[model samples]
Target: MIVFMGTPEFSVPILKMLIEEKYNVGLVVTQPDRLVGRKKILTPSLVKQVALENNIEVFQPENLRRNYQYIIDLKPSLIITASYGQILPKELLEKIPAVNIHGSLLPKYRGGAPIQYALFNGDDKTGITLMEMVYKMDAGDMIEKSEIEIDSNDDYGSLSEKLSIVGSNLLKKRLPDILSNNYTKTPQNEEEVTFAFTLKYSDEALDFNQTSKWNHQRIKGLSPNIGAHLIIDNVVVKVFKSQLSDIIDIKPHEIKIENKRLFIGCSDKAIEILELQQAGKKRLSTKDYLNGQNLFINGGMTNE
Candidate 1:
């Protein structure tokens, strides 16, 4: 029997793909449900919800390190993981061969936030990697890769959805070779290795000291989820969309409004805020926000 491990919406397509292909996915392992949102309502991880819907058993260990014997007891012939939040213990992998469907091409963005880093660096392309799961993080030998182009307007939400689809389909195509132990393992180049560590709360703040394009990429990298925010008059405003602006000659952090357009000064150019949310309000377009609020005024400055 095959064991599947994953969490988050990114892993849902992959789990569904396996089910559709009639893989004998005996058990699904994922992180435990936790309280979410201001209401503090308990929420199951997306993968758990999908597993239940498909009538599959799920294992959510509070700490997989201490509670992993359940997985070993099952004696699954193979394990497939995608965006599984926890690292499998070396002992677990020693007994069961496993593979991971990673979000980025191996030897690049080999960490938790590969998709976010790809956008942060303003890359035009990103891809998924199928690799052996070693004890070390994402430093696995690659089995196959599938590339996808990033649209100029793509943000974290859109790009993640795209990459998730690609990742699942790639796994489907490669599963036969994987099960038969007939796949080649290409070791990633040590010299080309780079990391995309998980983002912290502090990483969400926008820095106007950078170029407009740079800040724009930052906003896109964090959008539609943990949004990239700016502090204006000590109030947090989450920015979800922005564009390079032609308005110039303003100092960094300066706020400019003209014809109901909201522009903020960056080091080299101005960035026009397209969509944003105030501390206690729903997200709105720049024009709608300007029509209702006076937080940003001509010549006023945002907190740097």
Candidate 2:
């Protein structure tokens, strides 16, 4: 019997794949339901929803370290985790042969926010790593790795979806071999390791003092969710899509409107804002937003 532990939408694909392939998934362990969104409504995790739909037994422990005896009782032949929010207890790791499906190439971006960090760092490529689950965070010996290119237009939302698909496919192909002890495990070189720490709301703020390229990367890295933010006219505006502009000469954080298009200045160049949302307002394209307002070139926007 296999036990799968995961949370969030990223883990749903793998759980679905395992069910479709008829794996003996004995239980699905995930984080507990919590209040979400502006409404503060309780919401179940995607993994939990998938588990219930398939009629698989589910467990949600507030503290896995203290309450994992139930998992042990399940007699899981193998344990697998994909984006599981909590670290397994050391005792459990020592007792069970567990594997994790990580969102990046091993030894690089090895932490909870690998996908966001990859886009934040402007990596040209990112992939999935199937690795042995050690007590340390994502420092396991890798069993398999698969690569996927980060397209120029790919944002965090799109790239995450792509990585999810890639991870599930790779897991489907390698899991049987891994279960039978026929797969090879490779120790990661510690020297090349880099960390991708979890992001906070503060990390979403944009700095116009940086080059336009940097700002563009920051925008795309966090777009469609946890958008890159800036203050305009005392209102927090979340920028979702932007492109580097050839126009320059304006001071950093200066806002310019031309032909119904919105642009903001950075250190090196300007970025044309394609999509944005003002605080408490719906997201809109620059054209749609401009249609409701008129601006003069000399009227500047404040970062404060």
Candidate 3:
């Protein structure tokens, strides 16, 4: 029997493929969902929804290591863990040789938030790795891997979708091979391991003093998640869309409000704020935002 464990929208494809292939899946373990959005309605995880559609037994234990004794009692042959939130222990590894589906190629970005961190730090190429689970986090021996090229501008939200599908396709092809034979495992070099920690709200703060290239990279990297913020009159204004304007020889951090448009100068480039969202307000473009809030233009602020 096989055991598949994961959570989030990223992990849904692998679960679906496993069921489609008629693999003997003993159980599906996923994390509980929390409420999101303006109305604060309860939301179900993608994994849970897919599991229900296929009629698979799902266990949404708050802590699989603490609350779920049934998994141990079931004693499955192997565990295929992809984007499972918590870390699996040595005890769990002993029962079955668990293989992890990591988003980045092993010995590189070996942690959570790999897709986002890859873009933030400027990596042109990123890939997935199937590896043997070990005590340490993502330091396991690799079994299979697939690589992909990243566009000049790619964010977590967009890149995540591509990686999720790539990982699913790899699992669909490689699972049967892994189950049939004992493949050689190569250990990852600890020196090459780069930790891509989860993004914090604090990391989204933007600096207009940075170089044009860096400013552009950061804005594009964080576009759909943890958006860049600028301090306007000591207020943190979230930047939704920006473009590098014509080369301007202006002082750094000098915000220009012209024709109800917000412009900030960098070392070698000018950033035109097309869309912005202020505290206690909805996101809007330069034209729409200025209509309702005339004070912004009067106060030398062109964005909401």
Candidate 4:
């Protein structure tokens, strides 16, 4: 029996694939629900919903030992975790070699926020890594890996969706081998170890003082969700899409509209805004935005 552990929409495909292949999924384990957004609405995770649809037993564990011991008691043949937030304890590892579906090519970005971080860092390529779960943070021997290139304009949301689909198919292919016998894993060099860590609201605020190239990375990393923002006359403006410029005469925190486009020229880099959303307005192009409001704040393009 396979014990599936995950908690997001990305994890749904793998779980479904296992069921389609006639694998015995003993139970699905996911985290407990918590309030989200201003409404404080509690929502069950997407993985939980999928498992319930399949009539599979579900475990929402607040504490690994207390709530999840029942699953350990069942003694499933294998445990597969894809985007399961919590760390598996040593006791649980003793029961079985947990197979994890990680987003990045192993020995690379080894953490919860791999997809977003990769886009943010402007990585040329990222892939899915299948690894045997041991104790220390994503430090297991990799079972297999597949790489996918990041497009110049690709953001976190789009990249994540594609990678999730790739992960699902790769797991389907590797499952038979993983379940049958032990496979070799290459140890990730500590020197090459990097992190996604957890992204925060503050991280999403774009700083114009930095080079437009770096600003590009920050915006892309936070794209599609938790987007980068700018403060224009006490109103928060989201930068949904942008590109770098060679203009070096413009000052920071300034917005200039020219040729029906919004270009915020900076010290060494200028940002060409393609799409944006004001605090309470719908996202629209620079031309549409200009037409919508008569009074707009036009900060100085001059460094002075």
Q: State the lDDT of candidate 4 residue by residue for 158-204, as single tens digits.
A: 78778888899999988888888745667777888887776667777
Candidate 4: segments with Cα more than 4 A from true spot? 34-40, 63-66, 293-304
The weakest ten consecutive residues by lDDT in model 3 span 295-304
Clashes of each: 0, 0, 0, 1
Report model 4's TM-score to 2 decimal places: 0.87
TM-score per prediction, in order, is 0.95, 0.93, 0.86, 0.87
lDDT of each: 0.90, 0.88, 0.77, 0.81
Residues 1-304 of candidate 3: C-alpha lDDT, one tens digit per residue: 8878898777987888888889998788888876865567888778888888888888887776677567777888789888888877667777776788899988888777777677767788999998888888888998888999998657666787788889989888788778876577788888888887766776677776676556666666677645777666556677766777885866666667777776777777778877778766777897788778744444432232
Query: In terms of TM-score, which candidate is strongest?
Result: 1
The 10-residue segment with the lowest total lDDT in model 2: 295-304
Best candidate, lDDT-wise?
1
With candidate 3 superimposed using the best TM-score fit, by how many Å does residue 288's alpha carbon deviate from the native? 3.0
lDDT of 2: 0.88
Using alpha carbons, what is the TM-score of model 2? 0.93
Q: Is candidate 2 or candidate 3 better by TM-score?
A: 2
lDDT of 1 by residue, 1-304 (tens): 9999999889999999999999999999999888986578999999999999999999999888888888899998899999998889988989899999999987999999999999999999999999999999999899999999999999999999999999999999999999999989899999999999888877788899989998999999998887899987778889999999988888798888889888888999899999999888878999999898888873244555
Best-to-worst order by lDDT is 1, 2, 4, 3
Q: Compose the digit string of candidate 2's lDDT tens values, residues 1-304.
A: 9999999888999999999999999899999999976678999999999999999999999999999988887678899999999989998887778999999998999888899888888899999999999899899899999999999999988998999999999999999898999988899999999999778787888888888988888899897877898876566878899998999877788888878888788998888899988777778898897786543244445554
Cα lDDT for residue 166, model 3?
Answer: 91
